[model samples]
Target: MIREQLEKADAIEARIQEKKQDGAGPEELEMLRIEKARMLRPLTHPNANERVYLARRIDRPHLKDFIPNLFTDFLEMKGDHLYGDDHAILGGIAFFHGRAVSVVGHCKGHSAEENLACCFGMPRPEGYRKALRIMEEAEKFQRPILTFIDTPGAYPGKDAEEHGQGEAIARNLAAMSRLTVPVISIVTGEGNSGGALAIGVANRILMLEYAVYSVLSPEGFASILWKDASRAPEAAGKMHLTAEDLVEAGVVDEIVPEPLGGAQEDPGRLYASLDKAIQEALCSFDGMMPEEIRAQRWEKFRRIGNGE
Candidate 1:
């Protein structure tokens, strides 16, 4: 069902783009972009696998897309000090409604060549370290931290292991747990394993309605437990990795809804919704003492899945 919707949506989007490039009338283009887009529909109750596909759709907005739309004055920071910069994870300073903030997230580029350059958003140790660097700076300036998560996992290559991937991830977890400022993480797409979690620990965790957050990808889970990747769909069902599941489990604070046919089809609407979500989250931390903020974050995590 979703596959068909995606195909239809793609065709409509391509048509709109082609018409624009060919100097179509504004009314005609708007009719196609809006009215024709209305033809694309969403499942009333999509299965977990269907949602997973939506989350991984090539047209879905990524961190690179979200940053420019959601924030202002973004000054990108790079390098881990220990090694060269990793494009898989990008971070830096930005302003949210004029308030200084440190922003970071996995960067899964839009094109095949770009994704190859970004290692498909799988970060190495240095990438995590770079994220930590920007975050620690935020800690010093007493600015709120905002991280966007969308990675399958950290790089599993021998080179990443050699550079202490586990330790780097651990360091982030420990440091984030102790941060005095507000830490908000939004899982805009696939959030799997430690790559996602390294930047995910926060006072508030938000996920897109179609996003999936999990310990690992279903394929990996099936490969490890059943010794067959063919059971990935079954694994995904059992894993309960959808935004709805995570919110019910208290693993996510809120779900930022996407427009029908997903964020790619209506990016402006997604950004508008997300902008409000971020504002509410930031406002919730207003007037909170640094210790109070850290304590609230710790208490939030402590109660997750323990049935507070």
Candidate 2:
């Protein structure tokens, strides 16, 4: 039914465009607008499955898309001091609202070739280490840190484990917790497992309205709990992984509203809202001492799942 509504809305929009090209007048255009809205009424309140589908859309805005829109003077940094660079995770120094800040994010590609290059946005041990390196630099400079999380999890391959993936993630968690500068994390898409949390310890955590952050994917949870991945929709309901759920549970500080039909459908509006939210969040910590910032983060994490 949702698909049908979307298709109908698309068809109406196509007609409206065609009419405009053929010199349709104001009355005709206004009628078409009303019809389009009526056709899309059912989709105004999407269900869990629809939200998950929107969140995981390959065409949805990624870190690369957000960086150019939200920040300026981006100077990309690469590599962990101990090993080679990992393409899956991108980090750098960027100016947000003319203030120098460090940015890091999981970068999933839009095409098959790009995905292969980015290892499907799965970071290896070196990737976590690289993020830690950039974050430490941010701390040293007293620049606020911004992280965009969108990964299923860290790389679970033998090579990653052999190279100390667990240790790298653990180190990031410890380091980020005590970083002297403010850290803000936004879940732009899938925020799964330790991979997400490794870069996620922050003073302010925000999630896109359609985005999800959880210990594991709904399909993975379903497979483990019921031995059937096909029951993912059911699992999503039970897990309370949606942005609204997280906000209500105090796991997320704010929920940035997405554009109509999700962020993929209208990126410009999404970027504008996200940029404003980030600026406000960063400003909220203004003039606070480093210890106060660190203590706030510490208390924030400790309160999660404790109903605080």
Candidate 3:
């Protein structure tokens, strides 16, 4: 099934090329190419497996791509007071459109060494606590909170467990629930399990059109339920975790549009679109009081599954 998704669009492209070579003039060929481009199927409404693959593509935009492009004056904050620093979850204060905002997100590195250092964006207990610190700082300073979710899950290694990963994530959920400032979270890539939700309790939850967010990774779900990771494609189809599905279900407040294939195809456009969405989200809470902001956030989560 993964192979099916990765199969090149070679045949379709070849057929189009054949038409262009059929003695057409330059102007005619130009028009024909334009028509072909218009008909090229977009991953905007991609199937689950395709969406998952797109979300996992190495070239797709992640927190690393976003920070420099969307935010200014980003000052990287480090460490949880109780434990060591975690590169897996990057959090700091940044200026977004002239206003200060606390930004936190999972970091999947672009290189081998970076990946090892970032633990493939699977945050440990320290990472969650670091995120909590940044989030709380946002509330104290009365700045909006912006978080990006893009991890398979939290680090499940022995050290993480020994350091109380569950407790750290739980504390984040509880603290985020009561934060006095506006919180907006976007799923830029994979959003799996409590690792995603730890920083995802937001007044507005937005997901990229091609990103996949689920309770578990498809491979994990397949291995657990069917005892075979190879059945991941099947598991993906059944998950219903795509942006369109979540938006329709009211789990996501907005679906940020990406390029035809994925964010890697046009990351600049992705940045522009995401910037606008964040601006609008921040503006939405312009005149609300601290308690009002917290109450609105609570009500948003409460309405998620009740058809309100």
Candidate 4:
């Protein structure tokens, strides 16, 4: 059902783009807007598999697609130096607003083959290790770290467990929590489990409008409780994974609004908003000492479950 809606949405978007090229009249634009809105509205209330489907949508922008659009002179650094180079996590130095900083994000391929290579944005032990190494490097140079989280979770394969996936994630949490440099994590899409938090220990956490973050996916939760994945929609509503819900629960610091429908609809605009939010966050922490920043971060997380 959602697939059909997405296809129709894609067709409408293509038509709108074509009409614009041919100098679309206001009436044409308005008609196209209405058609697109219908598709977008239904998508806003996605079921569990639909949530996973949307996260893997071809139209959904990936970290690589947006980074180039957001920053200049991005030099990618590779390898964790132990297990191997994990393509799921890409890290490097980039100039954001003329300030050099380390940026890391989960990379998902736009196609099936690519997704396979990326493990569907599910990082293995090496990926978390690579991220920790990058964060350490960022701290060494006193550069702030910006992490774009969009993973489903850590890989559950036996091979991943053999390589110490849990330890890698734990190391990241411990290291990131103590690192003096400011850290900002943005949940641009699905942020599931320890995979997300391995790099999510940040001073500021922001999430896109349609993005969801949780320890487990809605379907997984539904299966455990209701024994039916079909009840995922109810699970999603209860999980409070949406940006607005996270913000209200104090789990996320801010809710970065996506373009009218969602980020997939306007990647450029989405990147711009993210760039601005990051810049503002960096500026606000300018004069604070490392100890002050660390204390603030700890305090923020500690207060999340306190009753109001």
Error of 2 at 31 (Å): 7.0
Model 3 pairs in collision: none
For model 3 the TM-score comes to 0.88
Which 10 consecutive residues of model 1 have the lowest summed lDDT? Answer: 35-44
Residues 31-106, candidate 2: write the lDDT tens digits: 9988987876667777777777878878789999999999999999999978799999999998988899999999
lDDT tens digits, residues 1-308, model 1?
A: 78887787688878988998999999998887775556664455678888788888877899899999999999999999988899999889999999999999999988899899999999999999999999999999999999999998999999999999999999999999999999999999899999999999999999999889999999999999999999988998999899889889999999999887677878999999999999999999999999999999999999988975
Question: What TM-score, computed on C-alpha atoms, does each candidate reach?
Answer: 0.95, 0.92, 0.88, 0.90
Which candidate, 1 or 3, would have the higher lDDT against the true structure?
A: 1
TM-score of 4: 0.90
Reference-based TM-score, model 2: 0.92
| Clash numbers, per candidate | 0, 0, 0, 0
Candidate 4 lDDT over residue span 7-90, tens digit each: 788899899889999998989899998989877786666654555556546567888886888778999988999869999998
Q: Which candidate is the best by TM-score?
A: 1
User: Model 2 segments beyond 4 Å from truth?
Assistant: 7-39
The alpha-carbon lDDT assigned to residue 72 of candidate 2 equals 95
Q: Write the per-residue lDDT of candidate 3 for residues 1-308, one digit (tens) a residue.
A: 33232234334445557767786577865775555454445333678987899888766787988999999999999999987899999989999989999999999877778789899999999999999999988888899999999998999999999999999999999999999999999999999999999999999998999899989999999999999999999999999889988987788999999877677656899899999999998999999999999999899888887876
Q: Give the poorly placed runs of model 4, Cα more than 4 Å off.
A: 1-6, 17-34, 37-56
Query: Candidate 3 at residue 166, lDDT?
Result: 97
Using alpha carbons, what is the TM-score of model 1? 0.95
* Deviation from native of the Cα of residue 249 in model 2, angstroms: 1.1
The worst-scoring run of ten residues by lDDT in candidate 3 lies at 1-10
